[model samples]
Target chain A: MPGTRARRSDAEVVAAVRAAVVEELAEVGLGRLTMDGIGQRAGIAKTSLYRRWDSPQAILLDALQAGFPQEQPTPAPTDDLRSDLIEALRLMIAWLTTPVARATGAILAERARYPELAEAVYTQVFEPKGGRFTGTVLRHYAAAGRIDPDRLTPVVLDIGEALVLKYTLDSGELPDEQTLADIVDQAVLPAADRPH
Target chain B: MPGTRARRSDAEVVAAVRAAVVEELAEVGLGRLTMDGIGQRAGIAKTSLYRRWDSPQAILLDALQAGFPQEQPTPAPTDDLRSDLIEALRLMIAWLTTPVARATGAILAERARYPELAEAVYTQVFEPKGGRFTGTVLRHYAAAGRIDPDRLTPVVLDIGEALVLKYTLDSGELPDEQTLADIVDQAVLPAADRPH
Candidate 1:
């Protein structure tokens, strides 16, 4: 096995390990994710894995943190809040289709069994990636004085994500482009927009 | 068993059957729920159950229909969109704690396996009572000419339930009163209120 593993570069080994963790999370889930299992899947040595990370959860969290997508708002505030917000949601929907998102969902579905790991997902994965889908967009405009900064309360920030997440949960499908626009125009913008 | 069941009123039998379905649903979920199990739990005969309902899912849908709560807006609305919204969200949180809620969650968690039953949850249990927790309150005020009727779009109406539902999904607990108030003030009311 060592001879077959070859002298792969450190970057190559890290990339392989990251991909393996995504698949491992979906297949084994929160429980039963072991260093040995990950090592075998990534074609790396368990001793080598231990040299870099301590636990399987740690490795999984690293991949999630690395894979989480950050939303971008348009540069120099065009005063078109609607388009920027919709673009942010589009980024979110695109990310929702990835292997990393599935891995995140897999961990969340077992929140009761692995409460700490679930918390880690929020703090380590989601929070660092803009908290919610429209958060960056809302905050970006708020910072530009186009929207009231005080209006970016947790509930306000959550409107787009909550509705979009609710739709996905209820329908088992991500919101379409029109649905995302509906969320932005009807929910997020109304909640976050400054009064005329 | 027959001796004990003797002389029971139709209402009494139906009540027993209703409670039995709730418990049966939690234990066996949608896939394994059966007439035999329900009859035994309710202390009614399988033939008696068949006389009332043709399928176990039908019996479950009936119980859910009976248990869904109807949210009440302030009789006059009194221009208190905030308080009414908070109350409506409170009603939703209360429903989420019921055994019927657990049954619904069990069904929804396996939506891929029982897609039709999940749809039935929406059309049968949820829609008849109200589309969302805040739907009745929003429509009531709109009818009174306070909020714009057009503001009560799908995303607007869903603001309360979506945030409450998302909160519960993340925390594994229902939103407290203060958080409900945040949802009203920060998200729901702003989206539903008439523009000045």
Candidate 2:
């Protein structure tokens, strides 16, 4: 029972630290995020936090990844490219509109003031997930002869996510079915499809 | 001499207040933006600011518009829809990458926490400008038979701005000429033109 309690308390401390990082990011933004503030907010010992993470950025990285768990693999495409794109975008929309994404957006919003952090996020957080997802889906379409090689660039791959991101950021809502469908049929498919 | 001095002082106050608003929004974001903070930062009386604008939101709207002045009209489409679309998208990139846009993006990044403010920005600022530009250009293309009537919808019209917005928000840079051209040629123009 003593051993179980010790392990349980440690697990709670981890969760608290993760939540505090996200909460602090939302409150003060990346420019002002600090280890002292995070420790105070999480009610954890500063030394213990320092023992685990090297910097506030490191804590933030773990918090974000923890908030959006990577245990679930991105869904693979089936036969239909259109359906696959729709499904992929739907999952993207779900993730981008989550509490974690919104909190991360708050920090990223200050990118002009904190370019290093922004770049870290791009390289460490966003690009890895978004890029991998885009690459996987685009390659699937390309392999099936549905998309041209020239059309497989980053900008084209970003079309669906970009549109959905804008709409979600603006409206604070994942777009309705009609809007998502239009993005897939009108924008994504056409951009990726081989031009006649 | 007295009249001239009065006008000059008023102009300075306006400039200071506007600059302060932009700076505050950049530093603390919309959630923490307050008149007291802005007044102290701008070196103006809080009462003076309150007299001109009803709320911090009003100050922000005025500041954003001031920072990204709207003197130049969005260019109308010429006979060549492709060239016209290119020109329009170029202007959008310019505006979307301005400091005002970046500050606005910072506030918008917290939309989940401040939905009412987000809606105000959408209705009062973004939609008004983005909608007008989209409508004016799309109508021109549609009337000239360059674009299909059905393609005159909002989503299709928004593809260029949406793409540019995402790129600007992500990289804090206006997309390069090639990226803009691709959106026009590969995405916007093709989407608008008669479907095969």
Candidate 3:
């Protein structure tokens, strides 16, 4: 009995651990994150957390992969490019302001310490959620020969995400309805629509 | 010695302190920045630093105002909006990747702790430098009746700067000539040009 292993390898434990990491990260941020604290928060034994993950960064990478919304919400197909882009960008704005994305501010600040984690967040989490807007919606528009081919690249796609990020960074919140409309009406629509 | 005031108003001392803050911020970033370290780096006393500024945030605000490039370089005039926008945005790309802009990544990371400092840096350093591109160059083009009046606003202006910042954040450097050209050609020009 003294040497026997307890019921481990439960998938629920993995989910709990990941949720604890994310919750702790949002509250205390990455600088002060600790496995002992995470184990406590998750109500799992310290030995359990240590057995599964090598470091806080390793857990963070797993948590990020789990915590991010698995699928970007598909925008409804509207005949108008403007409506489709607006809906897509609104989804992008909401995603950027999520607790997970907000928590990454701490990671990005400590990028020098955890370069791999930062890069993973950018590549694994951010690019895909943000990238789907262009890949799915804009690509469809371009395929219909509605948008200029020049506007189909990732660089052009960055325009909307960057605006939302910059606005949130400045104001500490997602932009309002008027601002989103301005982005879609004045920038996104103009930049993509093929000349008649 | 206590009776008499030491050389209290030397511009050189203030300049040295500000310069030291900027240099240290670039090298070690904000998390490791310390008043003692700044004093040592500036060859000034801790008492002197404390006397001038209440906290590191105060010093950072001062340094940001002093550190950013005062004027955005004006590109040469060209016949077409494409050439003009390309040259203007090239200057923008260079300006964005400067040490001062790169250093703000640290402040941005710790935005919760020092919101005012972040706002000050944004309003004073970033807005002015990034603002002029839209206010001056783009305004000139609009004035010439080459572009729509509705396009001349702060929101639309953010697209170019935001794109540059995103590219820098992702790649750890400014966009290349091809990327810059793509942004200007596909995004900026299309958004600004008027209908025939």
Candidate 4:
């Protein structure tokens, strides 16, 4: 009964650090995020954190990656590019409308000051998943003969990124299922129909 | 030369203060933007500045509004929706790539703390121009019988806002002229084309 409190494991400690970064970012914003604060919040020793991450920026980047969904959504072989694109758009929009979007915004703003953090994010978290998603959608469209194979990747990236950016920056409105459907019908499908 | 350096007029003082705000923002970012800094930089009496604006945010907002483009781009009716949309997108992309974009980003990031500034920007800068651009594009498509008359407004807003947001938030990559042309030919035209 005296030793009832559960001992936190190494993986649990890492998760705590990651969650603490998001909490601190939301509470105090990127301007005030510090490694010391993260250590205190995570209940981990400062030396332990320093050994793991070179700087607060590195910690922040790690936190962001840890927060991302483990299983990336893949577009199914719907054979209809429009439908598949719509579903993909919906998944992206859903992610943006969540707490993840706020954390992302903070990281992006902070990245202006810490170029290494930005590069890490671009290389590790942002680029890989976004690239994979785009590639999958484009390959499907290309295989179905819906879009020119050459333009598939660029078009998917452009349209998908635009949707996410628009909601995040301009309107602050989430692209709902209906909106995604409309975007696919109006923007993606038509673009795919163009002659090479 | 000493005589020429005599006390400035009211308009000159205002201009100096606005310029000081911009310069300070560029140097230290919005986090360090302050009225004291502005007064010192502009060589203006602090009392005079207080009389003009109630707070640093007010002064910054006024300066921002003064610097924003007053007139929206005129959408030329190219007799084709694709051409008109491409021209519009090009202009929008160019605007986002300028210094104004950075200033805008700072303001948006600050808006969570200052709601009044957000409202002012939305009403004065974003809403009016966004409405006009979306309306014009939709009108062009409607006239050509390319799109359903009813769905024109939403489609234009969705696509236009998406493109603008993409440039602002995600990659800062402006959709090139060729991409714009392709978007119009494939997406806009097809979306407008209804079932016969």
Candidate 5:
């Protein structure tokens, strides 16, 4: 029983540290993130933090990557590209309501003030997670020969997520299912080679 | 000479107060905005602010609408829809680098906390300034019979600004000339009825 408690507590400490980095970044911003602050917020010793992570930024990056969602595009006899794009956007909308999403927004909103942190987020978190929302699905379709490779430009791939983001930024609300369907049918499908 | 100075000082005071509202929103955020903070920042009397505006949100809305740029879709013999769409995005990029833009970001970013303020930004600033970037151009071309009116759906109209905002959020830099053109050619034109 004592040994089980020791192993479980180790996992708990790691989870606490991950959550603390996000909360810390939100409170102090990327510029003022400190190891001590993270440790205090997680209720761990500062030395314990240094043992695992070299700095506060590293821990934050680890947290972001750990929490970042991956879009799953299932291969089927009847794979629907339109439905897939909308589904990817739905994943994005769901992510928007999370603590990690808020942390990502915090880092990005002040990106002009803290360039390297933002860069690290891209290189470490988003890039490894499949570039951007809807990107994975597009790539999946392209690989399966369902879509023309030429149509999968960066701008085309970004249409669904981008419009959903703009909608949220303008309205302060997550897009509804109808909005997602509209995005897929009107903007995304046409650019993804499904012309009109 | 004294009369001219009095008239100039009055204009100067209004300008200072307008600038102060944006700066105060940046530092104190929307919820913390107050007459005392704005007056102290602008170095003016609180009574002077209330003379023209009823609340801090009122001043923010007024300042935003004052600074908001209108999209100008010029008519030429050729009247290139592609170039006009690109130009509209260029205007949006230019606006993205301003103090007012950052103030707008602060409001929209915290819109989940202040829904009314976000809605006010739309009704007061953006809708009056041609809905969204690329919106006026699409409408202009549609009205001129260069584009099909039915193609001007909300999702299609949003493709350009949404992509630019997503690009900036991802890369922490404004989209380059090539990137903007890609958005037009790959995304905007296709949705606007170009149909490659």
Candidate 6:
């Protein structure tokens, strides 16, 4: 397909493409998602699609990233780290149970064939959101003089990664609110407690 | 490819096919794996392979089940749930970093085409081991008059699923022992602490 006289900016193109991909995914599953299909749906030329995103996987990653809330809405710290962590977990669980999470699983299934796309999605989208949430919670604990700042990264990564993976692998039946509360109270909050 | 002399029993055929699947997955990654390849590797007729295992996914699931340790090793409870959990985590980390984990991931990638295989592997391989380990620790805690026995399943599933998923999604970078220790100390032990 040839480009029209009206040229869209890169951001506009990306946004359009991303929206089309999601709509396509809902209509036709991941197996049938193709660049040309997405291009047609987005009213963009296939050439334009390929020029920006290397493959359908890249486009799908872009779609997922765009779908998630860009700014991590700061959960007001409750002073009690356990409550704060629970709040974060609740929001994450809700997100994971949404359409975005389904699309993520579909993308992950295709990841082996497109390792670069997988890396891009992980680093650009999933990791950043996860890191931000983890960082904020850990920072709150550190400010209270409860946990060593050094322990933040590893703890957050381990727990956050685990939670996300569990939900994904389980096909989005996220841990219930009670379980989330239990996890924070039992694991996360205590881990932040000042050492004897 | 017709068998003349007494055909092998279904069990024997399943064993041969499963062994061949493992060998192929190990030698050639998931992308290159095929029914013909498995048949040739197993010294079985292509027809026999197709007839027995519905798809490559089925073959891989069978292989995973065959490879999984028959007995879920019970972690000896040292009356200290934390240490027991740490030991369990160590064992889990070791398993996840091994060839078994790699094969499991390969099998998982094909889950969309073979949903049954995913369920079978989850039930036969993952769930049983996780259940036994958690049960052992929880039983010890129960015997000591600590946490409620009813809570064991949810705890085990949440934590076990998370741990395994983290390892899988992270592409085999096993969480360090210290991280595992912290998880046990904070989550498992505290959850098992006697109710005041």
Report the lDDT of model 5 for residue B158. Answer: 88
The superposed Cα distance between candidate 6 and the true structure at residue B136, in angstroms, equals 3.1
The most accurate candidate by DockQ is 1
lDDT of 1 at A157: 86
| Candidate 1 per-residue lDDT over residues B1-196, each given as its tens digit | 4466368899999999999999988787677899999999998899999998999999999998888899888876266878888888888888888998888888888899889999999999999887888899889888988888988888788888999988987888888889998888878877777375
Please identify model 3 stretches exceeding 4 Å from their true place: A1-12, A26-37, A45-58, A70-80, A126-134, A143-150, B1-17, B24-63, B70-80, B96-99, B102-111, B126-134, B194-196
Instruction: State which candidate, 2 or 5, has the greater lDDT.
Output: 5
Superposed Cα deviation of residue B5, candidate 5 (Å): 4.1
C-alpha positional error of residue A68 in candidate 1 after TM-score superposition, expressed in Å:
0.8
Question: In candidate 2 chain A, where is summed lDDT lowest over 10 consecutive residues?
Answer: A69-78
Expressed as tens digits, the lDDT of each residue in A132-178 for candidate 3 is 45445677766666676666677667666677777776677788888
Q: Which tens-of-lDDT digit does each residue in A162-195 have in candidate 5?
A: 8998888776679999999999888887788663
Residues A1-196 of candidate 4: C-alpha lDDT, one tens digit per residue? 4356688888898888888888888888877888889898987778889888887767777877665543232445435555556666666666666565578766666665755655677687766565433345766557666667765535444665565455555454566677667666656655555544
lDDT of 4 at A60: 76
True contacts kept of each: 0.81, 0.46, 0.65, 0.47, 0.88, 0.39
Q: What is the lDDT of residue B35 in candidate 1?
A: 96
lDDT score of residue A68 within candidate 5: 89
DockQ-based ranking: 1, 5, 3, 2, 4, 6
- Name model 5 segments beyond 4 Å from true: A1-6, A9-13, A27-51, B1-6, B9-16, B23-51
Q: For candidate 1, what's the TM-score of chain A, rounded to 2 decimals?
A: 0.93
Across residues A1-196, which tens digit of lDDT does each residue of candidate 2 receive? Answer: 3344344377788889989988888888777889998998997768989999989989998877666523122344436676667777767767775668877776677787778877877777766554533456677657767677777776777778778876765566779888888987887777778465
In model 4 chain A, the worst 10-residue window by lDDT is A69-78
TM-score of chain B of 5: 0.92
DockQ per candidate, 2 decimals: 0.76, 0.44, 0.49, 0.37, 0.73, 0.28
TM-score, model 4 to reference: 0.70
- For candidate 3, what is the DockQ-based docking class? medium
